[model samples]
Target: MRKTSLDVTAARVSPALPRRIPRLPGRFPRRLPVRQVLCLLPLALVAVVAVQHWTVLTEGFGKLGTGEWPWLLAAATTTCLAWVAAAVTRQGAVVERMPVFRLLATQFAAGAANHLLPTGLGASAVNLRFMTVCGIPLARSSAALALYILAEAISRVTLLIALLLAFPSALRLSTLLPEGAVGPLLLAVAVATVVAAAVLLLVRRLRTAAVSFLRTALGEARSVHTRPARALALWGGSLAFPALQAAGLVAVGQALGLQIPAAHMAVAYLAATVAVALVPTPGGLGSVEAALIVTLVAAGGDAAVATAVVLTYRIITVWLPLLPGALTLGVLVRLKVI
Candidate 1:
């Protein structure tokens, strides 16, 4: 109640003084949040897969050594470029511009996830999470994912059609698909259509959700298309992804002495990938190998050599990148970048 000049000064300075933090006497610093650690789950899973496939990786690399080094190098380069394409496509999916390095890193990490989970579920999940972490709402993020998927699929099919038109005699159905495959494929498509219709008719909640999602996704797509730069990035990246992938396969074919023309190999690759698109395997695994080999053979490649080429190509494009990609994913998760 009767404070002097000294007391007033001390009281004023006390409020501004920093509180001392307790120092733990140990080399270890702080504990990480459990939620953040959970984000690193993919890294562990990828590591496990790597361990299980160690022999395959070694053999694939050894096979690469016997091929034309220049072509192999080209294949590797194309594989790397494919990641860049994926990053670009992801950016095109959303209106907001993401950090360049983190976007690139996420795409790289998503590569590992692609192999771990069936189809593209893993990569898609990683991207959705990344978008949410970057402050994008769940619904918008989902719509962006849909837009990316649609654009990529459209671009891939369009490229295939263009290639087929440009090179009339390059790919033949008899060479690639089994005679009865068309009938079964048609039946499967019909079944899928019917099932989708039935689901929409019977499941009221699902139907409402589907309609709402479609509206949101379409709106987002339209917004994205309105921006010329975004549209360009979306379509450009989409086209480049498939093109680079085919280029990698072609390079591998040349390296392994496959007697297919470059254009033919690209056509075969695109066709095979499209055919195997519906397969539920993780990264298309056995399905991809079978399709690629059969298609390559139809393109006039020796079956034995084509097998080697496909194997080498997958190793270079998928397996080799998994570890480093996983590492990048872990780093990003740890730093809360995603």
Candidate 2:
């Protein structure tokens, strides 16, 4: 039999695409120039502010050096536990099972990216890339990240509500304003609304989406309705992550010899965290510091003590992670992993 040209062409076509175009692995999409520049602005501002406030930061570090060793150690321990909690949440969401050690490494790398990248694209990029490495499709990874963000928002709001209920006076205490009579109250309401909306949307998405779709796109959602107990367990683990983070902040205050109570610390931390999260700043650098110090003072701390404690907390939580994150980025590049 004579071979037809159409028959030869049909055999050459790939399963991955419609026609016989050569299949090349795709590259990550380039960020738009305008967005990239906007992201860099916050990082730039962070550098400028840190440089301008070097003297104060130096003093804060000096105070940190004088902090009680046990308390400082405890702060680190609690923060480590927070990371463990985060990893547990992530593990429950992922599709394929990987070694725990590898997952932890990716988690560290993601944390580093969130701290070091100008726009924290590091976390998003790292998470997506890591998911790709685990054989998940891009859309599914994206959905997983969206779910993670929703989980975080819910947990943070829960903590915020707990703090507000415990310390009603904190409503009048934020240093985060033009000193308007109702500015803090308005901000609180705004934050609360955002948190509620985020949680509701996530819950609804998981509930309404078909099981097959959620299984592939956001696998954790499959359990959300069918297996409520597992879903709650995952949510509980995620909540523990941020709760431990707040605990770390409280320990930092105690470590610095600040006579702040844990309740006051929680309220101040929640308020400052919410305010700083609002800022466009990467990692909420200077904005976080400013909000934290002011909120701490409003929560009845001395200005100097509040400043010192928040500064130390940032050092441990922010700067300390940057070096490792930078190094991890380098390692990833060398491995051609990202």
Candidate 3:
């Protein structure tokens, strides 16, 4: 009777052992959620970029000790203020009032994202997500984004034009380009515009979308500008954003003892930024550096000093904030704030 009872106990437990074993394999093979993976991707890309640019970043830091500390401190201050300017502009773009603290944090994260993705996509994506979460409709959020971008670009270009006018000798446009290059460049731009327009006209779906987007964007722009405070914040912040960026570059130039006049340095910074705006590089990383070095040299700065200045400026504005920004982005994502 004892042996029979023992046999029954073994039989009952044996079946449950196989079920538990199967669950172990299932746990080992479990996959991460797609949303989680996507959320983490930007941080991963930023890490890869940092590794790739590690040597340049180290060299940039090496020159920092020799730089004028006061100017570098000013540059750092200006960089922080630029983020505030961006947050203000973002708030002005949409009618809904975002929580000020959250808005600023989003902009900080957006800046980090901007360096990870090309052509400002990361920043745009983060802002769109944030706005959507803040209860804005998708179309209106998108339209607001477009308006913000348009305002920023227009303000930057207007500032550049005004600066060029104020200091006429700051940039010699004719000498900056090769002989006979202007006409061809203009013609090519016109032809490309025509081609793009034709393609838009030929595609019915794209044409409809474009028209809808433009109408929505115009409506949003009108609504945002109807309020005096919003209008002022929108345009004023936009104007100050680029000015601060250029000022940072100037401060860096001063720190490195670059002989370029402050006004000329500002012009060079603006021109290089505008020229490389279409390069599609992440935060205009490599391209901006090259363009800055070349433009500064053209503006009568020594090539070696210009290179060092650009590197130092980028390190202060980009590298220092990168890790913090990435961490903010991750926290925001986990919290569903963006």
Task: Name the candidate that leads on lDDT.
Answer: 3
Comparing 1 with 2 on TM-score, the higher-scoring candidate is 1
The full ranking of all candidates by lDDT, starting with the best, is 3, 1, 2
Alpha carbon deviation, residue 84, candidate 2 (Å) = 1.5
Q: Write the per-residue lDDT of candidate 1 for residues 1-338, one digit (tens) a residue.
A: 78899998999999788799657688667898886676677777877877876776787777888899899999999998999999999999899999888888899988888888898897898899899999999999999999899899999999999999998788767866677888997899899999999999899999999999999999899899999999999999999999999999999988888888999999999999998998998878778989998888888888888888988998899887887887787777787776
- Relative to the true structure, how large is the alpha-carbon lDDT of every model? 0.88, 0.70, 0.92
Give the backbone clash total of model 3: 0
**Cα deviation of 68, candidate 2, in Å:** 0.7
lDDT of candidate 3 over 203-255, digit per residue (tens) = 99999999999999999999998998889889999999999999999999999
Give model 2 RMSD, 1 decimal: 9.8
**Worst lDDT 10-window in candidate 1:** 35-44
Clashing pairs in 1: none
TM-score of each: 0.87, 0.70, 0.91
Off by over 4 Å in 3: 1-28
Better of 1 and 3 by TM-score: 3
- Runs in model 2 deviating more than 4 A are 1-57, 118-120, 174-220, 223-233, 336-338
